[model samples]
Target: MSIQRELIETLQLNLIKHKVILLFGARQTGKTTLLKKLLTSDDDVLWLNGDESDVRLMLQNQTSAGLRAFIGAKKTVIIDEAQRIEDIGLTIKLIHDNYPEIKIIATGSSAFELKNKTNEPLTGRKLEFKLFQFSTKELVNHHGLLNENRLLQHRMIFGYYPDIVNNLGDETELLKNLADSYLFKDILMLDGIKKPEKLIKLLQALAFQVGSQVSYNEIGTLVGLDSKTIEKYVDLLEQSFVIFKLNSFSRNLRNELKFSRKIYFYDNGIRNAVINNFSPLAIRQDTGMLWENYLVSERMKRNHYDKNYCNSFFWRTKAQQEVDYLEEKNGKLFAYEFKWNSKKNAKITKTFTSNYPEAEINIITPENYLDFVL
Candidate 1:
């Protein structure tokens, strides 16, 4: 039931140098478990939960003595649910300024809260990492028994949640409950969101619209919310790691559908739950949606952990020609298309190639997608 996070190696190296590491991800993605595994060797590791009263009191007090009293001489401090404590940014700043030797690792589910509170204060002091549900690579390496085909098949059904993997009984119901209890609770309570039902409607709409161009007006009408509210909700969901928006990639801008963006759920398991339709893969209608979401999320996790700060998007044209994923990095473009079948005939657009002649194109099929994303 243990997954050896490769980020542990990166964390060990970062702690030897950096003052802080901010870990953020969706709920139940195993942020605490990863930190627990990392802090096992450090005898002085101090764990603080923002939900606890004593921990909140210590974090709110700005005095250097209070900070020192809480931190003590611990070489490493692990803060769980850091967003729960108000003014945690200043607290982290105080610790970073006063105790340069102390290495801090903080995790939170809400990036909007975490980043807004800490990004400016810990600008130069913090290294950020996004923990995601188990990736195919991690699952393969850790379990040592998942065949590629079987993994792909299971992924389309149960998804890659840590708890879902650990407790293999009725994963559909388990994931549905987790999504409701974790993601639903966190995202619905955001500021100024008076009605949480709209958020649920928006998520359901997005779940069905995977890999398709999304219209704000259409979404607003369908969800019974305004365009501005729809935009805000989408941003909140992205911040909370519930869904992702991928823009259309263009260079020359001719015949490119630049205004339209494609949306994908961060986890297929949750998407199914949101829609309340966990159909078996044998009779499922949205296999393409599952594949697209799984591939994009896996690549996102790999790039995030590897610290590859590349721009990612989808490519499509007026003629309905499209590429599933586009990665832009270091002045070059890489185009990718995801297909469940090993069909070699991907409708590459003339505009895409002409504008970015140096770009390379690859087809990601079930058999070889791991090398493309992982």
Candidate 2:
């Protein structure tokens, strides 16, 4: 892979002026791969990892002078897995303040750990980039972006993780390994939840209910836990990048369906893996779930990497009128419905049209979506 152009270009754009660049994502999203690509030109780059004992010792020295000495006179210094080091926030702050010219890049797996340590101290001094798995656009550079038919079919089956794309082995086994080894490990270690079994159970239930209103009380009842604990565990999963929550889009008090949010997996492959459902495109029962997840993931990448900041939501009413995604940008709201078929079945509701007369409503199908998203 000749390095996704977006990350390379983003590194070049942010590295020169910013004192600290923080890169974070789920495990195996290729943080190390992207950082190493950025290191190609500089011979003076210093790399330190908290996984190493000596680096942890140097970080915890409590003296700014020792930390400065460790940073040395390199033009660029990278701390991989910065969350493993104690007082990493103040240590990076020391280098950033004293050596204004030196550039620093740090990588972490979880946002909760990384942001808690770095966000407050490095305010206005840092640029954050999230390295997600291969986007439809990134995949386009290599294999060319998928067409409507193939994209919809493959997305539900194989998902967008980097290793899964490159592995070319049994996808079923690959997803299983990812869920068992990577996703579960982070949850157990970070949240101190002893039962990996319960997490798997919760996720499996979620897999069946994608794009539908999720009832935490019902989920707790099914999984044999209280609703509050279910919410906490779901938050933990979201923070770890295991799943993403889409809140209901509500502007009018009359028709808005409050207190009901839809959840989608960050990676459909992991979702399938947890549920142990590797049925081929022709035989799958959850094709709708797959389609919804693929669209949301693609849109998310466009929003993040392309710097298209917009408020996104799903719209529905008490009477069950719905739109899959609602985007608000530039004082205009845009409603979109994702359908696998190009045949149009979208109907704009009178209440929605009356509420936001300025907003545009359009159906995004396999044919015309690339022009909008890519």
Q: Write the per-residue lDDT of candidate 1 for residues 1-374, one digit (tens) a residue.
A: 78798688887787787568999888888888898887786678888888698888878867877888767778888889898888999888988898888888889988998998998888888888778888877877876544644767777777888888778668888987888887678777777577788888888899989989999999999989999989988888888888888888776577888777988887888888888877777798888888888888888888887778899999888888777889999988888878886765765577677777888988788878878666
Tell me how candidate 2 scores on lDDT.
Answer: 0.80
Candidate 2 segments exceeding 4 Å error: 146-152, 192-194, 349-351
lDDT of 2 by residue, 130-198 (tens): 888877787777776554335546666778788777766567787888888877776688744666778
Q: Looking at model 1, report the run of 10 residues with the lowest lDDT sum.
A: 143-152
Clashing pairs in 2: 140-145
**Clash number for each model:** 0, 1
Cα TM-score per model: 0.93, 0.92
Clashes of 2: 1
| RMSD of each predicted structure | 2.1, 2.3
In candidate 1 the C-alpha lDDT for residue 91 amounts to 89
